[model samples]
Target chain A: MSRIPEETLRVADRLAAAMAREMRDDRVAGAALPLALLAALLARALYAPDLVVLGSLGLPLAPSAWWPGSGFRLSLARAEALALRHADGRFALEDAFASVFRGRFAIWISPAQVDATGSANLSAIGDWRRPKVALVGSRGLPDDAGHIPMRYYLPRHEPRHLPAAVDFRSAPGRTPEDGRRGRRRGGPEVLVTPLGVFRFRPEGVVADSLFEGVTPEEVTRRTGFPVTGLPEAGRTPPPTAEETAWIRRLDPFGIRALELLPPREARLAAAAIAEAEGEGM
Target chain B: MLASLTDVAARVREASKAGRLVAFGGSGLHRKPLRAAEAIAEAAVPDLRLLAPLGGPEVDLLVLAGLVRRVVFSYVGFEFLGVAPAFRRAREEGAIEVEEWSEFAILAGLRAGVLGLPFHPLPGPATGDLARTAPLAEVRSPYAPHEPVAVVPALAPAVAIVHVPFAREDGTAFVPGDPYADRLVGLAADELFVTCDELVGPGEVPGPALFLAAEVTGVVPAPGGSCFTASPPFADLDVRGAIDYLESVEARLARPSARAAPGRAGGGRGR
Candidate 1:
């Protein structure tokens, strides 16, 4: 932020307003606003692509509506949706995750599991209700693109300050069964819970806490998901509002991939869309 | 062969039979009923089986009205159609078969049967548990590496009825986008009949190249069925309607298929 030239800064009105609206807590409001402003300002200068790091806010917020295991119960339904629609394997999941972990994909786990991770996983970027992210297996987007809609599910708990347990299936990496069956080839590093934020490292371990603004405790309390640990201390900033706006205007920045929403939600949304479409309105 | 959306609707309505089921969809998907193509579906599919991937409130009127019987699909299309009470009832009663199928497999299966394959191996991403849960993915040689065939048992209908914006006299048809699955249904059918809003010759279309292959056997010239599919030259989509349709289909698709041998029985023969 210090290096950014003053003239290059994009207005932070939308970002600021969104933050203000999203975070009702005053205590954290000051810091979040400034951080967002600074990051957005800095993003004006940095080549967003060169910015290997991302300060994803899908992370825990002071008052977030998302959590880790929120998708856990919904996993069955979500998994069912994916299985049903994806059995043929035409579209790719935004997140390369296996929902059941050790079991087959069901719509619900025990209520106990839901209590473990609190977030609902509805906090995907932009308007995407069921977001998916993937590697640029193809060539990267245009150089100026800002965000790659990489949908990852950070566990509710990390080794330490973990406020939430994350779902890794939402990240990179192929599930074991998928590997055995040769379905999804690999696994994801970081995760984007409806609440928590994460980033991947070259080392393969998902370093937590990519959303610089919110804390695990705050996020956990807000989203009811326990997000543990910050990234190895120095996380890269996210694209500022200017960069985001620029990318939106100049390029199709985000990855179009996303995973299925919890079954109930997905069913509802798809039904709404389908029904509306069927009506021919 | 030349017909309009309304003409197509009459054909579909005529194709309906009691206690018999037929799958209906187009390459151009729609969630709303206002579009002429979807209207064709509404007009044709009601009081019969609306066999789709899913259902929702959107088509509840169709469902509850007893106009729609059972819907089979992956997701509820309620949002697309408009919320309805009938679909919900069907779901509660365990009437719809929502077994999932991969987007590709759905198309490929139809294609394979049309192309003269017993089953086409559909080895791809099974996002939800539909592959294991759905009957569509159950086959002797599903995605076998050697053949990699997705056993698309011939989805031959007593009548492969479709509503397009354009129906040509030479059995050529046109719809929006590359309606690949429609082509599959067109080819692997005992008969391919169509209804449309307008009838056009090869001269009316961009070129003869745009017409589907010969498999689109019978071109029944009818108009006004372009409501669901967004058959171009007649209409485009409002997107909101598409969203609503997505939701309805999602709901209707909630029912899983009773998994059996993929092609245990069917109207058409597989390669």
Candidate 2:
């Protein structure tokens, strides 16, 4: 494993700890924290003086209304309320989607699986006639990836999740060559996984940065195919203290901490248990 | 006139008898017409084909009860809870057929239906192999013959069942959240049935009209009708209940003897 900077490790630890602390509560769902944190990050990255719609599964209310301690009202209704409050006028949902497709807005989606080429699968794991696993059908992903600029968030980054090729192409990624069928302006831009960050390139996906303590070898081992053009390994930029504080403010109940910690630690614990069993036996 | 939940189910049954396509609403538990769906499935209407953007417990229940013979949808699984088990079993058993569309295709198809067009042209990968088995046809662009375009045939549901936050006695309804494709489905369907948490007098309706009275065929007051799902201020999705239901269905499906249960045999209502 490549050595991770102490500071970078600390940042991942802190974020994981915060997520762990938030998970203690019974009400919060498993993906809620990471998703909310991702939402907050996206909101921060895209925030501007003018109104820009953040197209997600739903809308996000003001931090005060739906943040961690506020009972976390993360629903379509909450988003709708926020959209109504922020927009200058009313329009149909289709119009909003059309705007997103036209690249007038940005969207964040979580797919079941994504491949090196950026093709996503949310429909099935095997043949269409009878799938080994039937997932929620592809809603909007085809156009979302084909037209709108999208950022994908994968909570778990493993060979199965980030495969060499998705079993079924629910959404087609940008072609390797300039000549392709997708939108001229829109396609996948970035992928955020637990281990590292990647950006889509004409040739293929390239590793932009690794999280603290994650190695290029580790990433490649977990990935289905050999990842190309990994830059001289650098620490992923840690969340700024200000950004951390803003995240805390957005999730007053500390839900992010609780939601993130258990799984992170559980994996470590399992590894430790396996190591001990091997040594002792 | 205000209709009852049973009446709405009967209407759905009538549509089913006529071999009409039915479309429900929403992604998850939010804003779906669950009670009406359950009632329709319980009525044991056969040859029912469903056209929905997303599927939830109601769809699963109908599939398990053998009420739905075919489904044309984007996706069909319980969010977070995992894949809808009954749907998986039915698909595995080849008891039902599916015409899968990407979320974009389903929405675009509905738009085309509303426009009274034969098909809607779409760009990108959805036009590729995914369109092979689907009702999509490829056509050369008049301006650019070298560029191939995909055209998705319009999807017009015979009956659309939608659940909203508020509806007037006159049949116009209001949904406080993202209507998703509910409005388009309503507009594209031959008949629209709306179930609302609150029934209001005409002119007292709030927000924009999600479903116009002229377009809506029936207005039913069904408070908590979307129970175990969500209808906003009326109720939140009963997560515990949903998990319990999933477990129950899973357990029942696991039993060898239970495989021949009345629910799966097209006789009784699924618990």
Q: Report the C-alpha lDDT of model 2 over B1-271, residue by residue, as the tens digit.
A: 5787788777777777787789998766556787787777666777788886877777887886767888998777765455788888887677788888877788889988888899998755453236643687778889977878878999888888898879998888887665767878898888889988888876585776788789888888877667666565555445545655676778888875665332321211122
Best-matching candidate per lDDT? 2
- Candidate 2 lDDT over A188-257, as tens digits, reads 6767777767777767888877777888888888988667756575667656665555554543332232
What is candidate 1's CA lDDT for residue A190? 32
Report the error of model 2 at residue A256, Å: 5.4
Residue A38 of model 2 has an lDDT of: 34
Docking class of 2: acceptable
TM-score of chain B of each: 0.58, 0.90
Q: lDDT tens string, model 1, B161-219?
A: 55565656876665533232444555555556665555666566742232364656456
* Model 2 stretches with alpha carbons more than 4 Å out: A1-37, A40-42, A45-91, A174-183, A252-281, B123-129, B143-147, B259-271
